[model samples]
Target: MSQPNPSTTPFKAEQTFLAYNQTQAKAYVHGRPDYDRKLYDAVLQYHTSTNGQTDTVVDLGCGPGNVARALAPHFTHALGLDPSPGMVESARAQGGVSATSEPIRYELSTAEDFGCHLSPPVADHSVDLIVAANAAHWFDMDRFWATAARVLKPGGSVIVWTTGELRCHPDMPNCAAIQTALDHMQNTELMPYFNPGNILVRTRYAGLVLPWQLETPVPEFDQKTFVHRNWDVGEGFDNELPEVDLDRYETIMDTASMVTRWREAHPEKVGTEEDYVRRCRRTIERLLNEAGVEKGQEKIKGVMQGAMLILKRV
Candidate 1:
């Protein structure tokens, strides 16, 4: 049977992520940013020093195995788990990119139901670190935390992170007009289609309800071990590097989950899955041309605010 929709409220047992398919997976692989290497280094260092183990990592909601592959070198084994089979397939196809001795294995499983379906189930207190990159908002947090409590080794860590909305700054004439157009399109067209999970991301996950913080506190979890931080330096923080290329930025916009859903909902309206994307692209190019940004010379500096939540098992 097909998994239930994860979009619904109060998350039933049947709930599943159905929005992502092979096409979306391909777009995701191409458009998603490679998470900063510095973040991974710091997380690994902290995990090894605090937990005394760096042997295994389980990447939950691992779309295309990006995080798992990036981190495999530091661990003896890495597993990338996701609810979508198409995503898992894409991840496997993209394998062999890691320079590590360990290979990242991709599996079709949700964060809540992961260990239950494995042949040799993940043992209690076995996983050294658990991570969810740009995909934690969809989780049924209560169930996920319960699973984390069961699988995490003593002092093992859980690191969840997501990149937030983009803020554009173009170093061209009429910069204010360009920024205004971009903001209008994002706020008016794109924001309407975003799913409820986006609320968690917008709030930087600070408003998320953690199981350990529930009335009674989740057993086996250390309430005192939780930490959350917003790591994004904002738009003007990095000036040395060249700004985001407009073409690449457009491709990234196509990967938004809401855009995918909107495309599905309006198949007859356009040729592709993203009608708004076409419109936005056209609007951007038109505004750039009006502002005298020569063809193939348009660039805009932008930064996505990123947030992280770190926790440990007692």
Candidate 2:
């Protein structure tokens, strides 16, 4: 398939192809919620539980290589694949990695485009584990499953998870307003690419079965689904480390939209783009205040809650 121009706005097809690039990849590494230690434990346990030959692990959509960093120690080799150069860079920086190692390696490539780009990429039926952190939504699941099947060793497992709506404390008045906007965004066409649940189930319409027809189907693999909540009201309780400002936040949101940032990058529209960014910041400020976010605690809006579903390849 011909790749879309990176300079252009993102449509549905374009969105799928370029969802994880430098811009979103950068924010994704820093802005996404943390996966609980238990999540990592579950991953390790799944691999260990299956006394087969589990060695190499591939983290599809491994933004910033966060998941790879967590699993690197356990696996003989860990591969973090992504489409965004910026994200791959961030992953290399954060994942305590320099180049490819036994437990960790970062690649600037997409899961869908993995084999094509890799000169001698993973061989057929050679990989023991495959994972997609919060990024599987961007993949064509049928193609992804087929690709995974070709690479996974017999009895190898694939684990993919997506978080659910967050439940935060009511003290942060701004939380409610921000949440409302988030919910609204979800309902609108704006967030179709962001919702993992919708993306996964809907892939069936594309003639993709849920891993059932694989040569080694895992119909009854370990499944854990639940509402996960979180509360962190104290000061300095930031999610993305080092703490970025509202300006950075604005750039990320706009870049994610691609439509919104086209003007920003064009010199002729600088004035208009600046105004739009200001308005967005103001709107966020208003929503945060409505949610009980105080003047000094503008960052409190960063706190969040989420749910996770783990699908282990049996």
Candidate 3:
């Protein structure tokens, strides 16, 4: 008998992709998070060591071209690829360069489907390095690995990294407490959204191998995972939350408001915004209690810490 589908919520990839594009994505790029420059430097070093020179790098699952924009200076050429058209547009708008300057191109394509998208796809053995920043979760590892091998030249390598929350951000203690309380609730009451079934575990399988035999591992290839700690920085306040006019906070609130309005408009997208809102309010209340935020206090602040794994293919 054929195996039953593991997903219960009718896994329509296109819908999820579109929803991300329409709703949750901008917040992801703006609030999702950024990486430490040290990590980027280390990745560049690895690429240089492998190829003896770093020229062209490919950013797989490059949302908004954030990684590509960061690595552009280190390479002679860089390309950011993603399947979300909205994300591609955002990346282009943010990272687009003038014609006079060397440009980094952002294209829309899935990790496995790049073959069809790249008319004259990256020539075999041309790319010195391939980097997927915070995007491996959506990929099919086996096929992705095979495709990378096909495009990379001998001595080239692929690097995949996951960027999670910035638990260490000085102003994230409140956030941490909120998560703690939510965790407790999840373990006990276990709401439908917070249940184990709600968690989606995705991975990026990175390795170096030849094109002809996808299963055959390439010699001299090695892989290591790097642990990165991020500070919430309140979207860039790494050392501390910088003092600013109330408008800045209002802007953050505005983003939240927009998300709420969007959620309300499309209840089907977020799946019962009422429940999510209730959970969020409860989480905030628990966090306030944990942080000793007084009822009359005008504002509250706290800190958080989290980790990301970096894998080097060779």
Candidate 4:
């Protein structure tokens, strides 16, 4: 089954990662937290329930191939695709492999075209599952769904998910004040860097186009087979960072793509007093200090709220 969209509309802004250098790519890999096993379990359960195979899986927009690596152990062939050459290199360097120890392949491609655009194009209807993790907002959904329909075998699955807003844990010292500081950074300092992709994620994917919701609608996927799931704080997939010093806190915040863009647009402000991350660090440090969590480790705890959308090919 497949779906198609006519006269597709796309997001206005391109991702900053597409221009990443090796240094930036490594930093991105370092900053990102690996998703939990539970989330993978959920995906697998949903995929297999519809009689989807564990033969070949393709990860689109796979940065550093994190999601691809996670699911690789279950499939015979695990292919990760991203448009960024740097990201592809990083993913390859990270060592991809399947459950049988067969090396996974990471290629330079975009979600809009994926594996089918390589030197040797992937055969049509050869893929068993296609997934994107926190990366779909940057896609031209109409094109992506069309390509997905072309590559996916009948009864295959498409699972896309993202971690959304950060919620400071109540147990953290001066949690409310810390939350306020975090909000200030996002709503103020990083406001100008907000792109359509960021807005989609922040809104819990409200604006993300679904397989069946395209302008022309894809008949291969049925709306009845769609499943939406929300995970609150403590769900593990929210990517909680429990108690961290100022350095760790800043590093984690800097990992955000929005923050990366903010730094790029204001390189002069980076590491200077005007730096958004520096200001947020100071505010959080002050609040933690006021709570007696002086210049040390694990001063606060927070979680990323998340949402998942599952679609089964008919």
Candidate 5:
């Protein structure tokens, strides 16, 4: 994967997604997969074991509050911060709150400017946990780490995780062929429109530039406490999920940032944004039919390989 130019502004790379409207935000809410419950359980357990408390958690770049709401039950207060007003609105609309769950608050602020905008200014060393789910790839890591180091309490945990490369199970007939078609569409048709941040996800987050190092001393976090793990779902790995039908799969594809960019750039190719989606759906359906997979009857089991990074504050 090619690296973005060093001088490219973060906004330039993320403007499309950040400028999400109601329709786009709704698509994301419906399409994106929820994090496996076991992943949350394990992370919370680690936080408890390491810090002995789960007081507050700040979720940066929290798109639609998926991670924040899912993990809110394990903490006292869960604050989701994002620069996108549409995402914040969508998250607020979803509104998952219960007696056991931390009350979720969605704030419109960039990760780099988060602390300064807080009502009480997120006092130094006060946050017990910080997380960035699939949204971290777009962050300015150096600035984020600096903010994290300032807000996190001693032994507080920072968890960053992202999913990569959707894969279909090989057992299904013509699954490989269907996957090939989809891959061609994504890699060949939509590749140019993909933002620079996508490289981090394509590498399963191994390409992320972390401030702390495991083999060497670092200032922001404890090198000894760093942990990296990969969960391969539905591929003889942990957290296997149910098969996804064609409709669900299409919805997921619609949430791709590349698709959005493509629609904006090639309005002449497709009549409208909705027509572009219909065209892609038709393409997928035709591929599936060619593979002898019945549209509504047959479902495709797939795996989403995800990487998790956990580090404790110094």
Candidate 6:
């Protein structure tokens, strides 16, 4: 038989889904939530307050292009870059458009050197604002910062954010039990699937290297303007904050890259009692039963801690 295509391979250890096939991309697009308005406002206020232009915006590591779609209204031109071809295709199928009815473009590219090669040939130092929502931690910071310095105009800004571990809301019935179940589901059961990038996210990017920390420091970025912000659970960072039905919660958790890895690693267990998601549901359901949550009224809400880092180009 011909050698199996590497791109089609399953669960081979990778930094992060190196090849997000179409099915996986579609699942990601469906499962991920939009960033809350407060989150968007924080980024907008920082850039606008700093006199950053809004002509163009670039979203690096733009999985499924949600960030581009959400921020396109603020900029005349918006572009989303991701290394995965399946992700690019999945984004295009959304038909994302800007406030002026311009199409939001998604291109196949990596975070480190995306700006270096655009089909329309974006000029150096022309980009106004660059963002990487729930991304950035996976980037080669040295190359990414160098690329950011090259493409960002003077006073241009960059915003990056990521959500960390999820915790059950204290107000939920049998909340302690719920929390225990969630902790085991993520911290124990899924621990083996996590990669370095996932660990960076867990630390809320505190461990992420900045431009100045790199071996060859990129000096064009202004360290003085750098701002790091953290949001606790129920602080406008989580998607299903106040409440969400059990089904929606399942979908969101299933979208996690680690969950994908777990699924790939245990393909035979998928849809069975041994499946990670199924085990999670079983555990959560039993916990909910303690509170008499009714036969089918099961629901949950969580406080997911998150962090954001922002800096400006000199």
Pick the TM-score winner: 4
Better of 3 and 5 by lDDT: 5
TM-score of each: 0.86, 0.64, 0.65, 0.93, 0.87, 0.91
Instruction: Estimate, for each residue in 1-314, the C-alpha lDDT of model 2 and write its tens digit.
Output: 12222223132332432445556566554545467676677666866676545577888887777778777777777788877676777777776532245436788676866555676777887777787765665665545666776777766777666543333346545556666765564355333334333333223112223455445554444334211222223322224433345665555445343333344345464446345445555666777766566755554334433323334444
* Local distance difference test scores for all models: 0.72, 0.55, 0.53, 0.81, 0.75, 0.81
**C-alpha lDDT of candidate 1 relative to the true structure:** 0.72
Show model 5 residue runs off by greater than 4 Å: 1-13, 98-102, 213-218, 235-241, 268-280, 295-298
10 residues in a row with least lDDT, candidate 4:
1-10
- Which tens-of-lDDT digit does each residue in 1-314 have in candidate 5? 35564224353337876999767888898888777777788778888888545778888888799888877776777788888889989988887653355458888888877757768677788888888888778877767777788888888898888888778777656777767876776666678886667767877777666766323334968777788888775433234355777677667777878777887787776555355556556665676677787776656667678888898887
Better model by lDDT: candidate 1 vs candidate 3: 1
Candidate 4 deviant stretches above 4 angstroms: 1-10, 238-241
Model 2 local distance difference test score: 0.55
Predicted structure 1, TM vs. truth: 0.86
Query: Tens digits of per-residue lDDT for model 4 on 270-309?
Result: 9897898888777787888888875754365776778998
RMSD of each: 4.9, 7.5, 7.0, 4.4, 3.5, 5.8
Q: lDDT for model 6, on a 0 to 1 scale? A: 0.81
Better of 1 and 6 by TM-score: 6
Q: How close is candidate 5 to the true structure, as a TM-score?
A: 0.87
Worst 10 residues of 6 by lDDT: 1-10
lDDT by residue (tens digit), candidate 6, 1-314? 12222222232233445588778888887777777888888888999999999988999888788889888999988999888888888888886777687999888877877755777766788899999988786676767788888889999998999998877888888999888767866766788777667777878888778888776788998888789999886568845557788778888888888888898889999878898887887788888988988768888867778999999998
What digit string (tens of lDDT, one per residue) describes model 1 on residues 105-186? 8888889886578878778888989999877888877778888888888888888887767665445556677678877876
